[model samples]
Target chain A: MNGVHDMGGMDGFGRIEPERDEPVFHAPWEGRVMAMMRAMGCVGGWNLDMFRNARESQPPSFYLTASYYKSWEKTLETLLLERGLVMEEEIVASRSFSGSTVAGQPLRAEDVSKALKRQSYERSTSAAALFKVGDGVRTRNIHLPTHTRLPRYARGRRGTIERVHGCHVFPDSSAVGAGDDPQWLYTVVFDGSELWGTDDDPSLKVSVEAFEPYLEAL
Target chain B: MTLRVRALETVLLEKGLIDPAVLDLIVEAYETRIGPRNGAKVVARAWLDPDFKRALLEDATAAVSSLGHVGEIGDHLIAVENLPTLHNMVVCTLCSCYPTDLLGLPPVWYKSAPYRSRVVRNARGVLAEFGVNLPPEMEIRVWDSTAETRFLVLPMRPAGTEGFDVDALASLVTRDSMIGTGLPKLPEVGP
Candidate 1:
């Protein structure tokens, strides 16, 4: 979507100062927000990609100014509003007049650990990969208005395939309520000069995982 | 912000859409049970055992899962090792996609605009701010976690730790070291 969230090379933001002894959450609300997001995932209507799109699709002002959990909170709100899980007035009133119609069992406290377990996105495919290791390729200059893994900086740039990560769910389609639509994933490496105009450091390289749909034969 | 979150929670709870007990459990797990200490243990085991290191470098998912360190956002894991002539770091340019199961929630700096926008373009400069001054000749590889594949930088062990056990070595494996922003703690500095 070319949103401000796709921040790669565009600069002018100041230096990074790592906090000393940083806590898991800055406030109690942050933790609750995180837990709420995870718990909402158990509701089963939307995928992870949809949650991310809701957050990234926000206005630049909100995306930039909102803290991490604040973004999650907004994303949760956006998802709930869109899914009709809760009404706007209900949120404002901080209570529910009518019950939600969203289908899915609530995540129980006993099943929290199981719900938190990692789920594999890698899906088997009968098709062969278009590119292999050491193959030269160029990233397709795709600028979709939907969620995509292809960063703007590497779009249309030349790179070498480093590794084949097997087929995985394509975010572009998944974000829009499409099915798995898994594609071959590869680690494509580009020289620093290839990504940026010039490289001050001689030995600098950048790499991104490119799906088959985001690549073209060079 | 707090009130908004509380309000949202209130609505969800009143609507019977989510369980409050589940929320508390999730929060408690991340707060007390899971974190970078899990990644540190993995790194320490890899440093001590060559076969495990090779397995980790080959297939990090199975390796970490074998150690029972498994959770969401960590299903597809990749471990990039740092050497004398080579260094690797990770960033999700589009968003804050980190290995939450291994490192708990990402640090604020990782999700901030400055780190996300600059790390790929000026990793050396970014690392410098993190007190990591790599040699000019050494190659720097910046990994953008643009996909589901999460990354963990297996930082090189510090010198003069010949007899250190896994626990002792894990102490030196700081969270930043695994993120490739800083090297492991030196022996004299202590864990």
Candidate 2:
């Protein structure tokens, strides 16, 4: 969507401040928000792409000001509202008027460990990889409005395929009611000069795990 | 913001959409059980066992799983070694995608705009701020984890620590080193 959230390479954000002895969650509410998001994940209503899209689609003004967990809270609200699990008025009033039936059982406390295990996004595909290691390719000059894993900085840039990561679910297809359309993923490495158009650092290289859909034969 | 979160929780609870006990369990797991220590243990084992290190660089998911440090986000993990001539770092420019199962939740600075926006472009400059001043001859490889794959930097072991056990070596592995922001702590010199 070319939103402000595609923050790679843009300047003037100031210094990186590493907090000393930082806590996992700054406040109790932050933890609660995390739990809520994960719990909703077990409901099986949305995929990870939808969850990310909800957050990235936030208005720039709100997105820029909201804390990390606050953004999660907002994404939760949007997901619930979109799924008809909760209404705007209910969220505002902190009360549920409609007896909406949740589609699936919430994640049980005992199964939290299992739930935290890695989700397998890898899907079997008969399609062969279009590009191999050391093959030169270019990212399509695309500005997709929907959810996409390809970052804005790498678009329209030439790179070399460093490794092929097998077929995985395509986020662009899954985000907006599309199916789990899997595609071949590759690690494309670009020289710093190629991406930034400057020879400031000859030894610097940037790599992105680009889906086949985002790349073009150069 | 807390109030908003609480409000959403209230609605979810009243609608029977979530189990409160589950929320507590999730928080407790992250707060107590999972964290960077898991990654440190993995890194320490790799240092001690050359075969394991090879396996880790080849297939981190299976290698780390053998040690029982496996979980979500840690799947498809890739271990990039920081060699004398080349270094590796990781970032998620579009969002804060991190190996949370292995390293715990990402630090605030990692998710911040400055680090995400600048690290890929000026990695040497960013690493310098973290007290990781690499030489001009060292190549910096910044991996922007824009897909499901996550990255963990296998920092070079410090010199003169030949007999260090896994516990001793794990102690030297800091969270930042695994993330490529800082190097492992050097062995203390006796007076």
Candidate 3:
């Protein structure tokens, strides 16, 4: 989705102005939202890709104005509403819906650490690794409204494979309720000049993890 | 926002989807247990011991996990070391994907538009604003972290600390330094 979150090149936002010794959550609500998201994630209502897509699919204007966790809360609402976990009227009334269908297992307090560490994405398909380190590849110029790990700025650009990360969960298919569709993931390095043209400093380069489907022989 | 979050929590609680106790546990984990100190310790150990550094460089997950610091966004971390010729920094151009287990939640600026959008093309400029003015000849590499695999920048240690131990060295490793936005703290004033 071409949402405000795909902010890779366009400018006009002010200085980064990072806080000194930043906390995990600025306000207490942010932590609650994170906890809620974690608990909801355990409910198996949707995959992480779906949660990402839901946030990315938000109105650009609203997404821009909203804070980070605010966006998460909004996405949580959308997911719950879409999955029939809660009703719209109930949300408006601050009341719990009686017919909510949250039947999946809850992330119990004791299981929080385990749940956080679990990595369920890796799998080996009969498919062998396509590109090796140092192989030249180009990111497939793609623009889709659904979901993609490929950034808009890196699209159609040429890069050299830095490392073969082996097969991992493919986000494109996973976002739409499809299987992991394990694909070869590569850390491809592109010269900044290749991405931003001659104006960019030659000393600059960017590396992105491009799945097999997002690449083609350059 | 709190009202909305509270409402949602109420819904989930009432629906029996989640327990309030679990929410508090998650919050506490992010708040105290996980933080930049974790990454700092890793970086300090790497600086102190060459074998661990090589292990971290070869397979970050196993090396990091051996330290009992496993999970969260550190699920599949790739620790990129900053060297004299090559400088490494991380950003999530698409979204703010970070190794929360190692570095805790990212600073707000990392998720902002300026840092996310400009770092790819204008890393020097971005670094300049962060007070990191790299030499023109040194190459800069910006890493884009994804949900499955997050990247952490193992900032090079500063000179003049010949006798510093891991604990002392870790103090020099700030959060921004590990992110490649700011340099590690300078040597303390001589006694």
Candidate 4:
């Protein structure tokens, strides 16, 4: 699905220049590591059921596997290893795609791979709780990285707690691959005028599911 | 989960736990398949039936479930019908928790931070961006969907759309129509 960013082509308001250079570079084996980490993170964070169901179906194109990363090196490595097309150690030592060096030593394929995986896991697990379901609350407009169900328009807006949908998946900054941590999920309800002002129709009301961090006690 | 979603995916790829190919599939499935067709049905029905439309304005959930969509938000699903005297739009305000069961996934703009933040503050101006020019006399009701009660917009039945069946009427109810920015038009009025 095209996001707001993807709508750049629709009108003059959203246009952005495409990057001249490619965005990622990693070996095939290294790429598999990243794919696995993401899948695990998503399953653990947002929809574990989706991950399990996808695995059972064994759909060739499921995003839970390593073959789909864009970097050629990662794709090749995952294919060779998962399909047994190549030995494990052969690609580990190769450094053809090295973009930088750390600690005065060229970063090994394994070291970079490990760092990426660690980062993914850390993001899915962190978030502080400030409120709960059934509590009268208001939204805060502060922006941060990690998954947050709160919509932008409702910030600082008052609403009532509808339900504490047990901790489900968080979609804050981390859900999108940013470095931020996870947040709790809650459903909030708002009056028509609270959002649309006095001109709003009296007959209608809006309800939405949001994360805990995006809200505060009213 | 835009930037962080990507960043996390990158980290996972480096970890060798998941396959990047699978991630693409997940993204594709969500983007292409799981979206707002559910709510389009409601918008279509309201555009076609007067009795059902009346029922929706009075009690939206029952009216919608009559067509077979048990909303997933909570037990009490609220359907805000937009009328001539009043116009209603929905926004997550915090994120994009739309009535997927009735509407499917929200459109890209519906989930935007700009749309989410500004619509409630300057709804008239925002609607204008979508080419929705409303008279000042028309009340603009914006429903903030939070909590367990999900929301779907019941757009007004367009003029010149008489005699259309539910399916045909639904075909005219695009996602935007339910968002309160656009209205379903009769076949002759469409470009």
Query: How much is the lDDT of residue B188 in candidate 4?
Result: 66
Which wins on DockQ, candidate 1 or candidate 4? 1
DockQ of 3: 0.70
DockQ of each: 0.76, 0.77, 0.70, 0.09
Sort the predicted structures by TM-score, highest score first.
2, 1, 3, 4
**Segments of candidate 3 deviating more than 4 angstroms:** A118-120, B69-74
Report the Cα lDDT for residue A180, model 3. 89
Clashing pairs in 1: none
Model 3 per-residue lDDT tens digits across residues A1-54: 667788888889877777776677888899999888888888846998999999
How well is each residue in A1-218 modelled by candidate 1, as lDDT tens digits?
Answer: 89999999988889897999999999999999998888888884889899888999999998999888888888998898898888889888989989779766787888888777657789999999999999999999998988998999999999999999999999999999898998999999999989887735668899999999999989
Residues B1-191, model 3: lDDT tens digits: 77878887887788788889999998898888877889899999999999999999998878987875543344577898999999998999988888777887778888888899888888999999988898999999999875478888998889987889988999999988888888889888889
What is residue B188's positional error in candidate 1, in angstroms? 2.3
Across A1-218, the per-residue lDDT of candidate 2 in tens digits comes to 88889999999999999999999999999999988888888884999999999999999988888889888888988888888888889878988997757767778877788777768888899999899999999999988888888888899999999999999999999999888899999999999999997867889999999999999989
Cα error, candidate 1, residue A5 (Å): 0.4
Better of 2 and 3 by TM-score: 2
Q: What lDDT tens digits, residue by residue, belong to model 1 across residues B98-185?
A: 8777887789999999999999899999999998898889999999999888899999999999999999999999999988888999
- Against the true structure, what is every candidate's RMSD? 1.7, 1.3, 1.6, 13.2
Q: Residue A150 in candidate 1 has what lDDT?
A: 96
Model 1 chain B — which ten-residue stretch has the worst lDDT? B66-75
